[model samples]
Target chain A: MTTYNLALIGFGGVNRALAELIRDEPQRFSSLGFELRVVAITDLAFGSLVQGDGIDLAAVLAMPRGSSFDGLPGGSSDPRNEEVIKNSPADIVVEATFTSPVDGEPAVSHVRWAIESGKHVVTTNKGPVALQGTSLSKLAAGNGVRFEYEGAVMSGTPVIRLAHKMLGGLELNAVQGILNGTSNYVLGRMEAGLRLDEAIAEAQNLGYAEADPTADIGGSDVRLKVAILANELLGATIHPSDVHTTGIQDITSDDVAQALANGLRWKLIGEARRESDGRIVASVQPIALEADHPLAGISGATNAVSFTTDLLGAVTVSGPGAGRVETAYALISDIIAVDDFVKGAVRA
Target chain B: MTTYNLALIGFGGVNRALAELIRDEPQRFSSLGFELRVVAITDLAFGSLVQGDGIDLAAVLAMPRGSSFDGLPGGSSDPRNEEVIKNSPADIVVEATFTSPVDGEPAVSHVRWAIESGKHVVTTNKGPVALQGTSLSKLAAGNGVRFEYEGAVMSGTPVIRLAHKMLGGLELNAVQGILNGTSNYVLGRMEAGLRLDEAIAEAQNLGYAEADPTADIGGSDVRLKVAILANELLGATIHPSDVHTTGIQDITSDDVAQALANGLRWKLIGEARRESDGRIVASVQPIALEADHPLAGISGATNAVSFTTDLLGAVTVSGPGAGRVETAYALISDIIAVDDFVKGAVRA
Candidate 1:
């Protein structure tokens, strides 16, 4: 059996979930000539350590949750060690570090190092891709490696490959979606007669909203995603600031009641339409969509992206926008694609 | 410039449309290292002829409308001549001859010869694929060649690939769609308060229905498409006769009006659902669907397929069910996929 050495940049939620999926479907990977060997792991809390060949995933999963690997063979005494980066026998690097939108330096540094080392990188962090997509793409091309971030867009929805590869032949006219799940969940709760603060509090209670929900409610997150999509889809060099954004933070219960009275629903829509002048106009704003419209029916935290093309028309894919397994599925899909590229099963 | 040695088995509507699409987009093929060269033509009315190197597509397009190539450079003196097959140099064979489902001998024979002669085959013929998909698949595999018929299903909607490839990881529970366009158009017209005969006549006049619409209205066409999908999707190994079919031929104006009054629309749906016994129950029948349903909104000559999967939830793709350029797009998409497969860009 063929084996691929893998490095985990962060032992976070999505990385742990991917480890679970790999554990569950060992035979599927084995049949495809894939044996994922986690050779190293790096995290701020746990530091970095290298296991010579690979760590046994089953033993890793058997460890108690939330506990550090203090008993592992490669356990380190220093919290800021970088032995994993210096000595791991890994061929692919999975970067699942935290996102800092103002300055995407941490994720950017890891991605740059991975590309420089000629290792394929699969990431779930949207910060680096949103900040420096074109440069990173060029770097990967020059290094003859892959930089995939499908999980950064719509988790597990196949949005990136759908637009980039499956419908590559056709010219895309527009891409519109209910992109922000946290804001959508809040809006849906408000529509069900709850006040704004109450809905947000309930979302936090349910673990759907972050303790600091400004990134989600302020539309910054959706704006970054739209920027990535626009750059890849329309070939436009658009920064996050270039997108016209209006968060659902301004929408009140009165507006929701008024929309309901007028047979409409309030949805935070992220739309990128190609203008006649060939420049793309992208916006993330709350729209009063009629009941018959497709976007209006997308309720709760579900994410849906509608791709309009010249030849194949409109195809809409909707699913869970974010979850442990769902986002991990997106990351795994990217890994599979990278594996296919390495195996010469698909083009770069 | 790279060139592809190609041959056409028939000069029908789809073949003409394929030629037109290739002529329109010379750059697409040229960039992909393919220069489509139609080296031979075979037709019952125009007889068989051989053009060893390539046919001038521009000159063929300049021919007068409604004029067959009766006296072209490749025209034969004998109507029964098969010189195109006997003498031409073709690397790709497109078999689009009219299908006789009752006796699938001729189409089967042509496909076997094309595979045995070491030429990649792409066909829009439903007879061979529906009746003998297993044998043909095995034969193509044994010969180390491709046998693709994307046009045999939903024309250009990518239903076959969506089922077989895109939703690969998910456990699909059901595959349902509005598979036929002619019956849909007729039913839609009847719902607009026209008699069956009047609606059928209008459909024929509008080019939505055929002059002899038995195959479409009788549901045989939909049965063939469903058979192909079920076999490929569920691994049912089902025959056409095993499918329970009920066409729109018996649905009268009264039934349509009654259905409309009850807030429903009539659609010819082809469905394959898994039973508790691990068997598949496949059927093509006229069903009353509410307007809120995704399939109900698909009207005119449009088709929509909804897949219920264990993962990824429900996804729908709607597009033109059948048209010259649209169906030709499916053929070209298959050709591109085959080209990629042959070049090791995609694995089977």
Candidate 2:
């Protein structure tokens, strides 16, 4: 079997989910000639751990949920002290660190290190791709490695591959869709008669929204996603601040009821269109969409992106926008893309 | 330039559209290192022509619509009554012939010859793939060539690639979608208060429906497309007869009107699901979709397919189901696939 040494940059919920999915489907990966070996794991709170060859995944699963592996077998000698960048023997790095759209430095640093060290990088952090895609792409190009982040935008949906690879020849006209699942879920709840705080509380209870939830409900997360898409689709260098932003925080229950009465639905939409002058005009705003519009029916935590192209016309992809297993699927899909690229099956 | 020596099986509407799309943008194909050389064209009504090296696409575009190339420069010296297949010199065969689902023998014969001669084959003929995908795939595999018909299903939409290639690793549970464009257009028109015949007449006038229109409104067309999708998605042989057939023909304007009044839309949906017994079950019928359903809002000639998989969860792709440019885009996408396969970039 082709064993790949994997490094976990952060042992977050998504990384743990990836471990579970791979564990559950051992036969499938074995059939594909893949033997995933978790050689190291690194996190700020948990510090870093590097086993000589690989750690026992089965034993890791038996540990208590949300518990760090500082005292487990093959655990690092010094807990809360070692730097991840200085120590790790992995060919595939899974970067699931916290993202800050204000400055995508942490994720960017890990990506740069992975590419420069001739290791493939698969990330769910939108910050790196949104802010440093061009430079990271250049770094990967220079090092003959891959930088894939299918999880960064639409969870498990094939949006990045559809835009960057499948529709390679066509010139994209516009990309518009619901990019923030938390805001969408909150708005859907509000439309269903819940207050904003009530909906956010419910989302947090379901683990779909963060404790703060400002980045998601405020549409800043969607702005960052749109920035990534715009750079990839329109070849534009757009920052999150460059986009005109709006949030669902102001969407009252009355507004939702009014939209329903008008045979419409309210959604926090992130749209980026290439204007006639070749400048990319983008925004994340709450729009009253007709019930018949594609985006209007996307309820709950689902995410959908509609792409308008010169050749293939309008193509929309929708799926789970965020979840541990779904995001892990995206990370795995990104890894598979890198594998295909390494095998010379897909062009980068 | 990677010049492909191509012979036209039929100089029909789709062939003309593809020629025009290629003529309009030479740079698009040029960037991909493909120079499509239409060396010969054959049609029963329009006769046959053979230009030894290649035909000038620009000069051919100057001819009147539907006019034959009888007196063009370096045209066929052979009589118009003779078959061009016996005299044509080309490495690839493009079969855009009229579909005859009852037999599919004509296109199958041409496809066989192309494969036997080590020539790549690209077609818009649904009959062949529905009736003989297994045989053709085997033949193409044996000959080390390609057999692609992306336009056989959803025009320009990347359904085949999504099913057969991109999501190859996942175990697909179901493939459901609005597959027929003509029926969809007619149903949309009926929902807008037109009678069935009136809507069909409008569709015919707009070049969306064929002269007979029974193949579309009768749901046979959708059955064939579903069979193609099922074969790819399930990796099991499915005949067109295996599909549980129903059509929009019995759906009156009253039904559409009532559905609209009830906040629903009538769509001729084709659904294929894997049974617990491991058998594939499929149906083509007019289903009343709720306003919140993704397929409910898909109006006109648009098509959308939702794939439920073991890994990626649910993903939907919606796009132009049928159009001259759109269908031509499907053909070009197939060409690129074949090119990649030939260049050892993709696994067959």
For DockQ, the strongest prediction is 2
List the global CA lDDT of all models.
Answer: 0.77, 0.81
- In model 1, the Cα lDDT at residue A206 comes to 90
Which segments of candidate 2 are over 4 A away from where they belong?
A: A44-46, A65-68, A71-73, A77-86, A190-206, A257-264, A290-292, B65-67, B71-87, B189-198, B252-264, B290-292
Candidate 1 lDDT, A127-233, residue by residue in tens: 89988988998999899999999888887767877666566456788888888888989988898899888899999999989999988898999998898888878
**What are the per-residue Cα lDDT tens digits for candidate 2 across A16-122?**
88888766777756755566888887765555677758877677767665466677655653433224543567888898988878779788888887887788899
Backbone collision count in every prediction? Answer: 0, 0
C-alpha lDDT (0 to 100) for residue B271 of candidate 1? 87
TM-score of 1: 0.86
Give the number of the best model, judged by TM-score.
Answer: 2
Q: State how far residue A86 of model 2 sits from its true place (Å).
A: 5.0
Clashing pairs in 2: none
Model 2 residue B2 lDDT score: 79
Taking all chains together, the TM-score of candidate 2 against the true structure is 0.93
Q: Could you give the DockQ of candidate 2?
A: 0.54
